[model samples]
Target chain A: MTTIDYRLIDSTLRDGSHAISHQYYAEDVIRIVKGLDAAGVQVIEIAHGDGLGGSSFNYGFSAVPEKELIAAACDVTDQAKIACLLLPGIGIVDDLREVGALGVKVARIATHCTEADISEQHIKAAKELGMEAIGFLMMAHMNSPEGLVEQALLMQSYGADTLYIADSAGAMTTEDVRRRVNALVSALEIPVGVHAHNNLSMAVANSIAAYEEGAVNLDGTSAGLGAGAGNCPTEILAAVSTKYGINTGVDPLKLMDLAEEIVRPMMPRQQVIDRAGLILGYAGVYGSFLLHSQRAAERYGVSQAEILLELGRRKVVGGQEDMIIDVALELARKHAEQEV
Target chain B: MRCAIIGSGNIGTDLMIKMLRSEVLELVALVGIDPQSDGLARARSLGVQGPHEGPQWVLDHASEIDMIFDATSAYVHVRHYKQYAEAGIVAVDLTPAARGPKVIAAVNLEEHLNSPNINMVTCGGQATTPMVYAVRRAIETLPYAEMVSTIASKSAGPGTRQNIDEFTKTTSQALREIGGAETSKAIIVLNPAEPPIMMRNTVFAALPEGSDHSAVIESIYAMEKTVQSYVPGYHLKNRPVIEAGPFKTPGGDVPHRAVVLLEVEGAGDYLPAYAGNLDIMTAAAMKVGEAVAASRVSEARL
Candidate 1:
């Protein structure tokens, strides 16, 4: 068997915020950051569920401003590098500069799979600020391998230190992961990574497939605590990597302790492959949209499944939360027509 | 009543189609820098003069054209507006240049008809501002509003893609200035779906606590009627969805809020029916153009 070498990036404080409606207090940040750091994780990302400046009624508001959380995490962490995600329009360049000042070492500049052009200014700004810039092509399943490569090239051109194929919906199968990652690994001059969701219950397997296919960076959160069915559970991925003899430098036992004793208990709700979660993966809707869709479904008296399916049919992506209400309302209207 | 379209891209072409179907106006020229543009080609096939030289063609043929619809881009519209204004012609801008008073046909079209140049804030602004204005008219004390516009990726032309920042800025400004909110923000999403989706807008307004939901809903439905009179494809996807606040506003927490969902279907003029973003602009512009043409005829008769 080939010797495996990869990096485990913990997102318990970032993507995990979605599962809790982005209500991450400073204490939660410090505890999660200190735990992940001591576990020998290479990188820890902390931000609102939708990234920096993503605190509004549109996306849920963070309990405290992200800067305070970032500062708390930075102050506690000594081993792992601190990072954050920035989804261009939602988080401006000034937000990036502010986080960098708060000791964020890496800036993951993200955009929709086809909209990589919009990330240019943010990525360039991060680089100019002397930060390691990672380009995140979200909703990776939306584009073909060739299309992904073309968009990745645009990011690589703009000085992205690494490019991540972020499966925002957790919809890709292991084979799908391998194909897209292999294509990006071959096409990109920089290292390639994968940020997988567990909506389809494939996050760990898909992350493993991506690693085998040449993705050097893999992302996960504690107890699979994230959007939809949550992310690749960091502890489980660590254990699985050990079984495969991959050296992620992350302590599986510590991750397990953190996931069980600390993370799981704090979760507002358990992350499970419930009907709506599975439908998010099946329909290829965004993971962050799960809670919003559920609330909208309740508000409009429509099935969350119907909302997810229609959203998937429309290809509604991240940053299009408003489309959920539109979908739910349409379903309700159609139901009303039938009743009449 | 003689008019010209000043861009040959998706919007300009669609506008040309609407112009061709206009009863009160004559389309004298289709103007664009690209000689081989499909819009200009369509213009030539229909025996309307197609000019590759752009606004100068409209200038050279100034006597034949009374109005010019600038649909090129925000940056290009800057120069087109200046030239058209200097040439003593009426300019209707479809870009987010915001060089003149932003006009929503349903809310304040007649007010800007006499202005030398009128700016259509953006497709999102057009679809959203009317609802915001209606809410403001009903509540009269709205402090915050935010709009989210989702359009089909296929329908967004190069101009729309490049002007996204301006789209947000222009639309947000209109949401506050013309929509009459104390503060506002805008978001635009281009969905890459096969069998493209129609244009959709969500307008969120935070009214003071204990505001009358029925009054705001009634005003919004009435405003929808006004917009649909000219842009027939415009309609509410559902009745207004109102939620009591504890909602977040830029200023602080607010009391009650109203959320309006609007969908726009195209008239299948030059693009597909899903291209309502383009259709709404053209349809609204035609309504304004007809008003302008009527006034010109009245003056001529006088």
Candidate 2:
């Protein structure tokens, strides 16, 4: 086994935003950031679930402004750099300028796998502001390895420091992770990262595969508190890394305390591979759409799994939560008509 | 009327095929910067004048063209729009440059057809704005409207990918301008599904308390007919869904809101049937171009 030097990016504040319906208070940020920083996590992303400027009625508005949340995170973090995700359409270049002024150190400009070219301006803006720009090709399971590498090349050319394969759906298997990560690692000079969801309970296994295939950065949230079945749990990941004799620069014991004592107790809902989550992984639907799908399903009196399946059939990505309600409504109407 | 297409991308090439079937308009030239672009290659094979010099090609054959479809990127459309305006050419812009008044064929095409330059907004705008306009026409006021358009990832060309920010901005602004929404937000999704799916749009609008639900649904169906007149593939996947009581929106709480779902299948012009996003733009442009052509022909006859 090749030795891996991996870095953990704790996203309890970013992906975790989805679990909380984008209601992360400043106090939540301060505690989480401080805890993760002390536990030796190198990067912590803070923003709305969908990214900065994603606070709207359409995609649950954050209780507090993201800038304020970032400021709170910045105040607490002494070692870990503050990072934020920025989707091109949902979060524009102006959001980057605001985050840069808030002392954000890293900017992850994300786009749909085939839409990486949309991230060009945001990546350039992040680099111009002297931030470590990371290119995030979200919904990695949606694309082939070769197709992903081509998109990653666009981000690299636009000045991304690192490229991440974000299995936003938690859909990839270990082999899927290895193939894409290895291909991207070989094709691009920049380091590759993995952001896996635990929908199919494969987030940890996928992360390990990514590390084995030369991915240097991996994202996790304490207690797997994130969208869908949550993300790779930081404490579990650190413990697993120790088992593999890998140096992740994170203390397993400290991470366990953060996950068990700090994060899990405050979770709105325990992260589990429920029917909807399993369907998210199985159907390759984006995990971030989990809550919205659930809410829509309930509103339309349809099964959440059915909603996920329909959304997956439609190949809906992030920023398409509106599709969930639409699909649910249509399904409910069809059911009514069929009953008649 | 003799018309040229200024960009030979997915949208431009599709527009070229539609124009080739036009009853009134003559497709004069297909222009692009890439000599090897598939659009220009296809245009050449179809016996259309395919030139790679873009606006310069139109300028070289200035007398032969009366109107031009600017299907290039937003930044490129800005330059092409100015050049076309100077040469007294009517330009239909498919980019989100938003340099001219926005026109949706089902809503305000007649009002803006006489303008020298007309902006088609974005595909999302073309797909959702008409529904919002229909709601507004029925209720007379839409406090808030949010639109999300999901298209196949393979259907979005590089130009579409690069213009993501502009698309949201332009589409949302057009919702307010043409759709009569007091507050509007727009989102786009590029789905990377294999055997790519058709284009789908969701429009959410907050209505006044105890509004006429049947009247609004009737209005929406009527608007769907108008759009179908130009875009044969546009249809409602289901009847409009209405929800009651204190709905939360960015614009604030509303007592009632109507949810509309629309899907557009392509005409299978240049791209496949999954590329309805591109087809809608070409179809709307053709509608405007045909109007321009009819008016020009009548003037020449007189």
Candidate 3:
């Protein structure tokens, strides 16, 4: 049987921070980094869920400064390279420099799918810092495949070595992932990657579809610990890739034990396809909005589903988490009017 | 007063159009490095000189021009402001270069009119700083203030993208130094909505215990009217919201929080009406430029 080859970038510490409300401590980071390193994962990404400079009331404060966690991850990893995510507007070039000094080798510079032009400076800066710059297009479901190619070409021209289409909302169906990945893989000279979320329970299938469409890179998190329902589970993907003869260079049994022994105990709640999480995928809302929307819903005495649906109707993108409170308050006002 | 505009991008072109309608400021030329720029083309069609020699064109014509509007990027503005000052010309900067005193048209324009150079902090600063200042005016202490400005991605040109860091830093500083907050933070979001949303801002301020909510609201409403006098499209989206809280901020917790939501729609001069982010910067800079020009006219008379 012919083997399908790919590099796996695990984002449990970065994207998974959203599920825990940006509260990952140094010990948790060190434990997870050592576990993942031993499991043969190629890369491990660590940062605030909203990226660097994300510790504030807006995105929620990190329990420990992300730099401390980045240093811990850097210190723990052996075979795996350390990566960090930075949204240009939220995290600046200085943030990149600081993380780079702590041994961050990969810089994933993310922006809204239609706004890749903004990633030019950050991507160039990462390259200048001698980091492997990955241009990440978040909310890939928001734009057409051709539209994504146009934006991806801008990042490619800006010196990004790799490009990724992130289903930040967990909204894309397998076909949607295929079309976007195929278009990017076809148009770009650099390798393409896919970061998936399991809100729709389609993260694994979509990631496999992305690989079939010629994506050489794929992303996952241990035990599916990430925003919304969660990301594609690292252990599950490794196991599935093994069964399919796809060489992901990861030890499936080691990841499974790491997930069960180390990561699951630290999670606030087990990642599940609950109502709010499901709505994130169904309504095409950002995955990180799940926790924020739930908090606003409880505070305002409104339904989390209603808040998620309304946010979807408004078409709010990532970085607009503050809109959750605005939507919940408006819905509460409407419900009060109805009761009157 | 005779004046010229440098950097004929979307902001520069929009400022040129707005300045053409001003009673005090005369539209002399639109300067840029590209001869085929749409701003220069529009300037030529409108019977104003459109030169392709960059800032040098403005300096060469300094004898006739009294004030110059520098609508270029932050780096370009930083390089040219000293030259403009040496030429005895008053420069109104629209970039976040912060080479001079930051001037918000409604808050502190008159104070800096005589200054050799005035900086319009940022579109976000112009939109939300007034709200922060209003709260500070009503309450004795504003410990923490944070603002989030979300605009259509289509409206954010290359200049805005490159200066994203400067935008946040300058806007945050404006909230404290100008809006009277002890500490402040700024966040910007570029929304890629298809029908293109208007520029929207949310300002959050934490006040001490026993602060007066009604006085804060009254102060904010009055400030809204003052800003509206110059930016006709600016207005509050809802009544000012005051919530009881030990709202967590980087500075510390506070007893009360004030929330203000604002929407800005452009006048459709050069860009679409949805591009209020660009509109506010150009409009506020025009207000500062006119006040400076009128003040200079009266100064010459004196």
Candidate lDDT (C-alpha), each = 0.87, 0.88, 0.91
- lDDT by residue (tens digit), candidate 2, B205-227: 88987678899999999988989
Off by over 4 Å in 1: A1-4, A37-42, A67-82, A88-105, A115-132, A300-302, A330-340, B1-3, B23-28, B54-67, B78-90, B112-116, B289-302
Tell me how far the alpha carbon of residue B226 in candidate 1 is from the true structure, in angstroms, after superposition: 0.6
- Where does candidate 2 chain B have its weakest 10-residue lDDT segment? B243-252
Best by DockQ: 3
DockQ of 2: 0.49
Candidate 3: deviation at residue B259, Å?
A: 2.5
lDDT of each residue in B96-141, candidate 3, tens digit only: 9998999988888898888998999999999999999999999988
Model 1's DockQ? 0.35
Rate residue B280 of model 3 by lDDT: 89
lDDT of 2 at A84: 96
Ranking of models by DockQ:
3, 2, 1
**Which of 1 and 2 is the better model by DockQ?**
2
Candidate ordering by TM-score (highest first): 3, 2, 1
Better of 1 and 3 by TM-score: 3
**What's the lDDT of the predicted structure labeled candidate 2?**
0.88
Question: Residue A287: error of model 3 in Å?
Answer: 0.7
Residue-level lDDT tens digits of model 2 in A120-219:
8889999999999999999899889999999999999999999998999999999999999989999999999999999999999999889999999999
Per-candidate TM-scores read 0.89, 0.92, 0.96
